[model samples]
Target: MGTLRDAMGYPVLRAGIILLVLALLISIAGLYRVDKSYSSSGTLGEGMHYLGDDKFENEYLYHNRTLTLSSTNATISLLQGSEMYNYTLVNDSVTLHPEMRPAIYVFNGEVNYTYDARAIDYPYAVYSIGAFVIMLAGIALSFIGYTQFLKDVKGGKK
Candidate 1:
């Protein structure tokens, strides 16, 4: 630990660098999100049924001929955590917009009975927070070893 070169090779410094790399990997994993797709038959909005929860970013609607979201002019209470998105319907296929926008869809009581949707379920990542903590710890530890080496090189051991 007599020079910066020696400090870079110090065991603590090496461990800190390893932790930094691990943190980077964890952060990357955090960005990787998996979308869930599913189809449901029967009543989409009748009696009581939920679409998705806050745990989901947003649910994209894909309507087939066997599906109509709600009865014609049915009241959709936005206060219930359910929102609308802009979408385009071609033939029997529905494509949701990538960005969220206030677009009301009225099915006019079409005789479609099945609803399929793709939802991005992850709104938060525990791995990202963990990676941030690891990064901070690694920087702190690396600097600790760096200063120790610098002090030894200056012959100011106290």
Candidate 2:
């Protein structure tokens, strides 16, 4: 134990510990509680069609819906682990924010989803605690190595 402590008695070790702790804190804050939601909207687009029994071929009545396809002013923050970009719905009641807010994806077969953010199903307490523990371990290891190096240098270990 004494020899181990000596190896970790360096300023570098202290800096390493601080860095590890900061990393852990940031990760926990960012990922510990992720909000999830789901939402969708239907729109009519004009395009070519098939002509059979007097059907409208290569034309659609929804042409005037062109103005409906305008983009909304919504920015999304995509997390590292998450596959979709989570965004907030703006004031517009009929616009889809780019972010994939985690709401119920399916209730019936309506094909329309709600736009809301929700906490993940799992509890974050456990993960937060584990991250903290790992950070502490990293700090301890750094400290030990630093002390050891200091001792070796002072005693001419070469």
Tens digit of lDDT per residue, candidate 1, span 40-155?
45433323344323333234333221123333334332121265443223344333222322123333323223444465544346679999999998898877877766777789
Number of colliding residue pairs in each model: 5, 24
lDDT of 2 by residue, 43-95 (tens): 21222211121222112122111111122333233232255433333433233
lDDT (0 to 1) per candidate: 0.52, 0.41
- Worst ten in a row by lDDT for model 1: 95-104
Please report how far candidate 1 places residue 131 from its true position, in Å: 1.5
Q: Give stretches of model 2 more than 4 Å off.
A: 1-34, 37-125
Which has the greatest TM-score?
A: 1
- Give the Cα RMSD of candidate 2: 17.0
Candidate 1 positional error at 19, Å: 1.4
TM per candidate: 0.54, 0.29
Error of 1 at 30 (Å): 1.5
Error of 1 at 82 (Å): 10
